[model samples]
Target: MLENKVALVTGAGRGIGREMALMMAAHGAKVVVNDPGVSLEGKDETDGPANEVVRDIKAAGGDAVADYGSVSDSASAKAMVTRAMDTFGKIDVVVNNAGILRDVIFHKMTDEDWDSVIKVHLYGSYYVSRAAAEHFRKQESGTFVHMTSTSGLVGNPGQANYSAAKMGIIGLSKSLALDMAKFNVRSNCISPFAWSRMIGSIPNTPDQEERLKSLRMLTPDKIAPVAVFLASDDSKEVNGQIFAVRGNEVFLMSQPRPLRSVHRSEGWTPETLRDHMLPTLKPSFIPLHMSRDVFSWTPV
Candidate 1:
């Protein structure tokens, strides 16, 4: 589907990112696999993972190259794009799958926890997309498939930083879609439910552990097909959409929409809002719950 194209996939060292890199290459996209090889918490980095993925692609008779650069830095991100263009002539697709986890309940969350997650997930996404958008603007064509999370779309305890960053990705993709639509540049995000190292390493209760065994059926490979579709012309008209992929099921998530409104002849006072608007809007409000709670079905 992506023959004659070149793609750069950040966080391609392991998990979903690694699978995405391989899938794109299999589909005939020369891939630039970028991975700093950082641990789950973004420490103890190495180059082995990225090199191994590149080797695997080559062994599979696919085309790929290793890029040992962290996506968190704007300069490094620009260099990643340059490598793709330099190696394969031009970049047609970019997958922002790089991320880190710093999970902690809000009150107990340290500054380091919050900052690290935002840096990698939010700022890193921006750096890559910003670099790609510039090149895409010049070429007048490009596609971006960014990674989001159900934790962000719904809610997840102990993931304030991650949830916030992931949600930011959705907004970023949406606005980018609107801004670059005229240029034929496309952007979309996927909120994936997959069993990856990040999830495996996080502490879980007995129930979560049991649930995760089921969730494992929705492996990273299952999510890669969605990324491929988004990257290819198959999704040419599918910009700014958020897709939730769980096992064999794919869901189109609804964006925020107004449900109810209360207007007065004059401006609304706090008391008036409390008495009138609250009652009118209460029925329309969706209850806040953890993402897993909202989608508690067994993985199919």
Candidate 2:
């Protein structure tokens, strides 16, 4: 579906990024596998996952190249994009799949942890997307697939840093979708619950793993096709949306709820607040899908 298109994927050395790069290549895109060969905590290593994916792509008769640039660094991100242009002359898709997890409670989360997670996930997407947007604008057509997380949507304990970064991508994707609409550049975010090194360490028994495997709910490959669709012409009209992909289930998430006024007329008194505000302030819940009557107080 992506014949003659050039695609760049960060964190493509292994896991979902690797699968996404391979899937795009299999669909006829000339892929650029960008991975810093890092661990889950952003520590650098000498692994060749990026090179290996490129080799796999070439072995499958698809075009691919390897890039060991860190997506968090502006210069490295620029270089990665430059490599795609240098290798294929034009960039048609960019997958910001590079991310890191620094799990910690709000009290225990240090400044370093917060900054590092933000740098890798939030700023990484920003740097890479900004660099690619220039090229996509020139072409007047491009796709940006950002790898977000369910943790961002449903706040997970002990993952404040990670959740904040992931949620920021949602906002960034939405704004970019609107800003780049005129240029035919589509931006979308995907929250994938896949079995990767990041999730492997999350206290799971062999039986649990077997059960999940049987259910087919946590494989990285299962998430790749959705990403491929987003990167292909199939999703040309889909923009500013956040999707959750896990096994056979694909969830179209809702936007953040706008603040609502409970009682504006007779406010400010403690007694009035106790009687009126407390009762009137209904829990604002956002529905998963868009509907004509969004403000209805009915249960789904």
Candidate 3:
């Protein structure tokens, strides 16, 4: 599906990113596998992960190159795109899959904890996308597949930083789709429910044991097909959208839309809002629930 295309997949060292890179290559995409080998908390960088994935792709008769650059830095992020163009002559697709976890309760979260996660997930996504925009505009075609999360789409505790970043990515993807549609540039997001090093870092309790067991069944490879589909011409009609991929289930997630509303034609004060508007809107209020609470069923 991706013959003669060039794709840049960040965090392609392992897990979901690695799966997407390999799968894209198998489908005839020349892949730029970008990974700095950072730990779950975004430290301890190494080049081994990126190099290994490149070797694996080459061994399978697929073309690929390693890029050991931090996506959080503007120059480094741009370098990844530059590498793709320099090596393959052009970049047709970009997958913003690089991320790190600094899981902490909102009350106890430190500046560094919040900033690090935001830097890697949100800023990293923006920097890379902006760099590629110029080329995509000139070429008149490109695709972006961003890795979002249910934690952001629904809700999750002890992940203020991560959740905020992921939600920001969704907004970024939507705006990109709207702003660049004239140039035939497309952007979409994937909320993946998979077990990886990032998932393993989440705070676990006795209550989550069964849920964790179910999560273990959702391997990262299951999410790759969605990425491949979004990157190829098959998804040309898909943009500014979000899809959630579970074990064997693929869900088209809904975006923000008004469920209910109450208005006072006379423009009443706070008293009217508290008595009339509250009652009218209360019936349509969304429940305060975590991501797991909303997806309570076992993985299919």
Candidate 4:
């Protein structure tokens, strides 16, 4: 369905990004596989990972090229977009799937921990998207498939930095969608629960071991077709939306909506708010529960 399209997938070396790159290629996109080959914690880099994936695509009779550039850098990200235009002559999709994990409680979270995660997940998405956004706007068309997380959607402890970054992408995606809607450019994000190197590193509680197994069942491949769909013309009218994917399940996440409200023609003081408005609004407060509590079910 994406034939003749060119797609740039960041962090395409491994995990979900790899699957997305492969799937996009199999569906006839000339894929640009951009991976700096960093470990989960954002340390070290290599060339082999990106090259291996590029090789796999070629072996499968798909067209692809390896890009060893960090998405956290705008110049490098622009280079990825340039590679696509130079290689395939036009860009159709850009998937910001590259990310790193630095799990630590807020109390113990260092400047480095917070900064690194933000640099990768948040700024990485931004720099890459910004680079592609310019191109998309100029061309009057393009698609952005960004990666968000359940940690950000619901609330996960010990991932303040990661969650904050992921959630920030949701806001960014919405703004981009609104800003680019006039240009026929669409932007969307996916909160994927998949077993990858990043999720595997999280220290699961004893009760979560079985949940981890379920995560394994919801592998990265399950999330790839969704990327392809958003990138293709199939999602022409879909924009500024957040979706959650697990196994065979695809959920449309609740957008921020009004739960309750109160008004006083005479206006109100903190005293009035505390005595009346707070109580009126308390019943509608959404509880912050971990996704596991919400999405637990038999896996496909």
Question: Which structure among the candidates has the greatest TM-score?
Answer: 3
Model 2 stretches with alpha carbons more than 4 Å out: 203-217, 259-261, 266-271, 283-300
Instruction: Give me the displacement of residue 120 in model 4, in angstroms.
Output: 0.8
Clashes of 4: 0
| Backbone collision tally, model 2 | 0
Query: Which residue pairs in candidate 1 collide?
Result: none
Cα lDDT tens digits, model 1, 111-222, are 9999999999989999999988888999999999999998899998889999999999999999999999999999999888888989886667786877888877878999
The best-first sequence of candidates by TM-score reads 3, 1, 4, 2
- What's the TM-score of every candidate structure? 0.98, 0.89, 0.99, 0.97
Regions of candidate 4 where Cα sits further than 4 Å from its true position: none
Q: Which stretches of candidate 1 lie over 4 Å from their true place?
A: none
Top candidate by lDDT = 3
Whole-model lDDT per candidate: 0.91, 0.85, 0.95, 0.90
The full ranking of all candidates by lDDT, starting with the best, is 3, 1, 4, 2
lDDT of 2 by residue, 1-300 (tens): 889999999999999998999999999999999998988888888659998999999999999999999988999999999999999999999999998887776898799999998999999999999999999998899999998876778765677788889889998999899999999999999988677888765444465555445434467998899999999998888999998876777889888675676656645898877877777765554444312122222211
Count of clashing pairs, candidate 3: 0
